[model samples]
Target: MVVMWMVTGGAGYIGAHVVQAFLDEGMAVVVLDDLSSGHAEFVPEGVPLVRGSILDTPLVEAALREHGVDGVVHLAGFKYAGVSVQRPLHTYAQNVTGTAHLLEAMDAAGVRRIVFSSSAAVYGTPDVDLVTERTPTAPESPYGESKLIGEWLLRDAARATADDDAPLRHTSLRYFNVVGSGRPDLYDSSPHNLFPLVIEALLAGRTPRINGTDYPTPDGTCVRDYVHVADLARSHVVAARALEAGTSLEPVYNLGSGDGVSVREIMTTMADVTGIAFEPDVAPRRPGDPARIVASGELAARDLDWRMRHSLTEMARSAWEARRQA
Candidate 1:
């Protein structure tokens, strides 16, 4: 059975990898992106491209019906946590309003089965080190709150459309720090992500700035789970197949490496990967920065049969390679 997939923000870092994964598995893709934060070169050839916004209901609905889209991978939204705090209204408009528009379009077009890109921000700063899928959601910033709301929208949509007469089956994968590149041709440019920024600083012969040196962690810096984009991409594929097979039972999941690494560790790995002895400048902690936010994928594994397959070193190396090629 040939399944047509519609991917919003498919030209972005994570979305490009997901597009590649779907194509590799012999599935068709129709990418819808505005090229605001995403690059045109990242999208692969032969995939249908729609240049528009996810909030554009008529366009999204037309794409769904025209492409015979059976499933959708929703990746379009404002993702910068810091910026979201400064501009709460903007984040809500993009993440919340855009999601509502997408769901409405899907329902109108009679398309079922959606795999949504949620965030670890939903958990915010966890009280425990390894945050499980069962962790209580306490979002601190607008970005986190917006994504949490996105999850709620999916849940409500699924419940409303669960009847045989209705349409819409959905899975929301909440993840943290997605690093690495699936293809050098598809790397991010001037990204707000820490990994990309650090790499940029190193390549520019400047000292990378550390957020803080007074955190409770051993290195006095925050610890986070940095999963590879490829691994995350594979998880989306597994999710789609699971939904098709009636195997995925939950509408929400946490996708992470299940291990924590400090900011200093990432700097050290960047040096190791690039063979550059670069010094990092210690700076004050950024506002609203979480001390440590690591998540467990046990629930995802048990349900979608997913696992983290990439290491920290591999993650750094791939990003460094893409930087060099860029």
Candidate 2:
């Protein structure tokens, strides 16, 4: 039988790319998105787009059963870290409660495999130069805390179902700065992410502002691991295949570049990619902003075929082109 997967939030930037990746692999997919932050237009034609929140247990369960979903890629959540700080209750409601509800529905529907879309925010401000799976988690934002809790939910659920005929197999991919676009029609529309912030500012003839220039880094700006959305999306397919094959995967894998790119460097690349010439306005550090957070994708690389397939220039250029098309 052909495996059918449900991509929650499948119309969002990353989720849409993941949906495309599944299609490229000849896998059947159905999307379940509330169109809250996701664009309905991003979901491709012929794929069923269930327009409902994952919080609706009956709706999700019915969708799962009706579609014969064998696995789920859970990406539906409140995603902004900064905004999450101001709206902790809202964040918890969407990410934490929403994940719990999805799990409940999956349990009811007998969907036994899941690939969770987690965040590096779960690590908060890591002192280590290269974050690994061993890095201690100290989530600073409610968004991060909620993602960590979601992972806990999966772990505890798997433990509870260990002896069952079909145990709940799962893996969480901890994303670090997912940028760029896999297709021109699908671009990051997030107001909070760096790529869209810079791209939107330039498109409006405004100089992009860097959050901080006094960070403890080579360029005095915050550093992060930037990964292309397509590359990140491809790994989700790999994880799904692993689960379907009953292959044991680590509970969590960091999908990262294993290298750091500073904010100023990104500014230069954006300028080069877009043919815009302007210096970024230096602003005070955003409170709670970490100086650096880069991670090694060795585990993901070994198991999920994860790697940096796109260069930094390609990341910036693809993002700019897609946003321009939008």
Q: Write candidate 1's Cα lDDT for 5-84 as tens digits.
A: 88899988889999999999888888999888987788898988899999899999998999899889999998988778
Determine which window of 10 residues in candidate 2 has minimal summed lDDT. Answer: 282-291
Q: Give all candidates' CA lDDT scores.
A: 0.87, 0.95
Position 132, candidate 2: lDDT: 98
Q: Local error of candidate 2 at 145, Å? A: 0.9
lDDT, candidate 2, equals 0.95
Model 1, residue 143: displacement in angstroms? 0.3
Deviation of model 1 at 191, angstroms: 3.2
**Candidate 2 Cα outliers beyond 4 Å, as residue runs:** none
Clash counts for all predictions: 0, 0
Q: What RMSD does each model have against the real structure?
A: 1.2, 0.8
